[model samples]
Target: SVCHANSIRAEQAETFVADRLKEIVQLPEVLPRLVAALNEEIVRQSQPLEQELVVLLERKEELKTKIEKWEAALEDSPELFPMLKDRLDELTEKRRQLHIRENEILGIFQQGEPIQVKDVQRILTSLDRFLAQSEKKQIKALYRTFIEKITFDPNHKEM
Candidate 1:
């Protein structure tokens, strides 16, 4: 009895599916060729993203090689040691300034004011100016310190 009931349900499901397919086939505006064309376009659009990823991977490899070469050069030059040290010190100072600015910005965000596009632009411009000035000062200091170190070194070879 159970097998007979299951067969009847299966027959009803097959009839329903056939009816739906017939309705779809009878539709006037649905074109299989257009659907296939749209699907092909979607596939074509996705292909460029794969190409972009490959380009990015190649760029990353190039940058890695450049960075490794720079590191090796720095290691081979003893004069670069003190210059790098000064640069690191300058970076630390700039980072401290940035931290203060970040905290101020966070406080502003916490104040619940509606930030407009102009406000964001103004803030970004101000930050850029401040960082540029700070970087200039840091570079000047670094150069001065490097020059002083070079002059003070007893064993320094004039180049």
Candidate 2:
């Protein structure tokens, strides 16, 4: 009798769960946007590239200021001339390299496209391989556009 009662209770619980699940599934209001967000793909944009370009330009400006200060210091004290000249040369070379890199990033933006799922995954897998230096910000910004929100559905246990 105990076993029979337990079996009946189990069957009732299963039936109740089944009915509740059907009710939740039939409710269209609950699952649309969440499903859309999960299914939607991501695309690349220019904000990230522009962000890096801004940084590079700022660094180049700072380098110019540093070089100018060193030049002024050298004129004030010829005894420190050789060291200051070396530093200015290093700063000038660094600024030149930044200029070259900014141009490269601009080139990448010129060749833009609507990136898909595979492309996003590939970029995520090897961010460094996709871009270099300040362009890492670009990669991060691109990835952010993906999965911007995680909408949970308890009924389906999905995004």
**Model 1 — TM-score against the truth?**
0.30
Give the number of the best model, judged by TM-score: 2
List lDDT for all candidates, in order.
Answer: 0.48, 0.59
Off by over 4 Å in 2: 1-45, 113-159
Task: List candidate 1 stretches off by more than 4 Å.
Answer: 1-35, 78-159
Q: Model 1: how far is 91 from its true place, Å?
A: 16
lDDT of 1 at 126: 59
Instruction: Write one digit per residue (lDDT tens) for candidate 1, span 11-106.
Output: 343334334334434453443544556557656765565565556556546555655565676789967866676555554555455455545544
